[model samples]
Target: MSSGIPYTWDTDCIRASATCRAEGRLGKGTKHHPLEIQSTTTKKVVYLSDSGSSSLHTVGERMDWKRLTLVFCWLECASAAGISCRNEQGQAVDWYILYKQPSINDENGLVYLYMDESTGGWVPAHNPIDDQKSALAQTLLPLFQHFTNETINFGYILYNDQPPEPFKTASSSFGHSKGLVMMDQETGIWLSHSTPHFPGFDITGFWPNSGYANGQTFICGTYKYSAFRNIAVQLQYIHVYSFDAYIPEYFYPELQCVVDKGCYPKKTPWDRQLNMTSLGGHSFISYAKYSRYHDDLYSGLLDKHLESAFYAKSWGRLLDPLPSNCSVDFSVYNVETVQLPTTEPYSITKDHSKWCVTMDSKLHRWTCIADMNREVSQEHRGGGAICTDNAAVWSAFLDIVNTYQPCQS
Candidate 1:
């Protein structure tokens, strides 16, 4: 009944024990040593060595071997609870980034590279998409648990232009964007991603293989509860897939639209632009363009601040339109090919990811990850981008621009 640091089993030892048990050799000989288990629930180290002894071990004589075994089983079940993306270690992280490579890479396109504070740059993830160890799984797993476990009280919204089927049929004039927001009383996370029909439907509780076909991107940031206010203002510009507010007492009036399953009914869809600082202190400017504004976000909204031409990718040529020419000073071009560091060049057609960067490096290092593309059909779509001036992030994205098609004068 006491609460403290949860017990963590040695993953290696656990695997070894499982293997022994499978081979029917566990506890067979004196040479087999007791499995070592550590409990951090107490202030001091409490070692429990399961050696198959008949004598009952006791903690303060009040808790016997039988009680300990039951407690251990409960702990195991609790630790195994939640969705795939829960923080397994229960450690707080500033932020994490994921880049899902296209299937063209030979491996399952679902495989992705992740970057965190511990990792200076991108590292190939060791776990698969479904594995709890994977960054995506750990980050998103909590959402599943929040819905399934009533004991977990939180608020969340899953919004995407193309939401999961059945639910997708219910919407009308939703924005062209994809993102998710989930939070408790203390802190929360806002995940901005570029995949559709993702994280699966409520009934399925699974990750869809359909999202793995083309390249995709996801940026997750942990933030204080106050940050959700700014996030709510921004979501007004995007589409809502499926939204549920468990703690209605904590809901803001603006956020209630999500709960109502309706878009704001305003003649002039309000477009907003603002600076957002993540819990990690990373600076990002959000450009939220509502559907009422019929213009390309890059050329009409961001070109002035960026002060340089851009190369963006939308859908393929069949649906793609001419690149937008800047009315002010710079132009926005269509990206034809994308080449990432240490990766082969690939056509934009193969990339469902939507992002762009300033062509000239001298202009304040700008890289943007947006939800909508430059296709003609998207001009009036509600969507936005999270842009950063960080040199490292900008350089990482800038270096991948292989070629672009300039707008005709």
Candidate 2:
């Protein structure tokens, strides 16, 4: 995780990429096996020559769309079944969030509260969190069912701080993040969660045994193909540690780096902010910081940009956690206790989830599900946050801040 070789994006490169997308030069697709990919291994894959190069060619030849009309037709036909976030009933949804409750004395912690645009607030899960027909299972059905098949219409990347067995632990400076990015040539979904060593390279049994203990959170959003390119650029700043990926030739050039487990920043101003719009037109802001940028991601960065005081809940069991800070323009407090409906209050130490919510929902109403903890060790790590101002999402997080540590006198 040492700093990457310096790379720069000039104005010409930006214009070339914009033109490439505008012309729909994304190439033909291919199928891949996730468990077999190695970051160090080089594959004979197609890549757009530096950003300044505009022509899209594969294997040193210009594409003939007329001869490849069949491929285009297949993509259009498959786009109808593109990947997306699903609700508890296995229906496609614009966005959704699940708060898996922790196990108590008589409970096994299988139950969770589900929320989406349709579910005004939070609704009790129809099935257990790990059940096959659950929302997560249904959402991933395409990847699980089609991965081994020869279909080349879709691609996916699974990344996490604590990946499945055999994958070595990421460098301490890498982002403390866990999530999956899946998509077709047309649309896709980005799922951000706080679970570790979960939903591994395997196709079935989406949840792992360790995921049943502590409370966790997941946010899933559906976006068009162009947005995935933006997401790939943001991951470069986050320095994501991707354990498994299947990037077809049809994917945008920005995503090719994921196949090699690369997200090292290419230039100075090692941080980036972007407004990504979902297919349904919901607005979300992504914030990313490279590992070399030393600062507290929440108090020192996000709070001021969001222009609001925050109540943050992160892994409190770690050593040397940052105390609440009020000296800055926007104060950031540490959440101490969380209480959900029908459950007793629990200490933040038992939760490994990382998220922050605006202190005043009436004014800001912002909630961010992010990577990185409010601990001294994570201050130097590369990480990012996905934030939204949707009322339902904002209320769900704000309600969880039952108690927090105020700045000392």
Candidate 3:
């Protein structure tokens, strides 16, 4: 995996395309031949011609051959139906984080910094954050292109605190989280972001105008299909306000309840924690809390679970932001200023991103991207955090903390 390289989109297949339904083969037999085929038959198998022609010659038991083809088609469809996180270059990545800078000092907020496993530190984005070729847009290409596909193989759920037009008001008790989950039966991407009304219900110009003023962050990871079961269960704890969702009726029975209004929890466990593994084998921990929890996310939950002091960065426009606290075993401080490697330092007032990292890199290097803000009102809201201890990810976040407020007492 390398950065600063132009991606060639011509070599890749159209992900989740209904026209490319898994039959015996799926792909245009162009120069390199990206088609994947597997069939058990007595007839001799022939490779697709370089002229982009589908050719097959075989003679055997008619009914048996048809049965074998149908069986293979099912297998092929499952294997070919993949939805993963794509990078700026249109290449698949295990995970990536984007930090969109605040539009201060006569600059548009479209400027952002990008980091992934390959990039040791934050790299200045080559294009505007909302551009089609940017990392976020490329990763969402599948959702934008196939949202209305008639195939039952695709599934998605778009949730946010501030929904799109006609339904902008969100429930006060719902989670403050904002993100979208989209995927096929094989694999999918879980993108957790800190922008309001982003990638809205309508596909036309997904980015919202309100997001241009404050800084925001996005963390995306690709996970296997089975992992969504745990993820779906956790979303219930978060009590997400899903603005738009398309959960296929027959496929992914575990996800059906997510969009089902009747299935929303009334009184159950206030919170839940689950461990998940990405398709690339990276481990992540999801910590979710319901409104019934009635506590601050970082000091009351994360600090105790991880047993490490934290420097949290959250939206600074709150009416009464919680100050740094040293009352707990693991103290939690508020980040006041941020300085990215490629950008000038800015106050938290210009940023709305919610994230935190361990104060000491020696003992604990946990980094979390969450939706909860350190404030009085948010204490009663349902929200959650996704955390990882990956060294690269930790370092990238740790390096951005330029200043923070210490315990006042």
Q: Name the lDDT of candidate 2.
A: 0.73
For model 1, what is the C-alpha lDDT against the true structure?
0.62
Question: Which candidate number has the best TM-score?
Answer: 3
Give the alpha carbon lDDT tens digit for every residue of 1-409 in model 2.
0122111111112222222122232233223211111112221122223332222223436655453333223233223245788765455788888888887763758788888888777888888989866788767766675554535777888888888777877877668788888888778999988888867543356688787767888889999988888899887678788888888886887777855765578678878898989888899998888877788899877976878898988886888899999998999999999987747888876677889999785778899988788988888888888999998888878887789999988
RMSD of 3: 8.6
Residue clash pairs of candidate 2: none
Query: How does residue 122 of candidate 2 score in lDDT?
Result: 81
- Candidate 1: give the clashing pairs: 84-137, 85-137, 85-138, 85-141
In order, the Cα lDDT scores of the candidates are: 0.62, 0.73, 0.75
lDDT by residue (346-385, candidate 1, tens digit) is 8877778888777787766787888877767677777888
**Clashing residue pairs for model 3:** none
Could you give the candidate ranking by TM-score, starting with the highest?
Answer: 3, 2, 1
Q: Alpha-carbon error at 59 in model 3, in Å?
A: 22
> Is candidate 1 or 2 superior in TM-score?
2
By lDDT, the best candidate is 3
Error of 1 at 149 (Å): 1.6
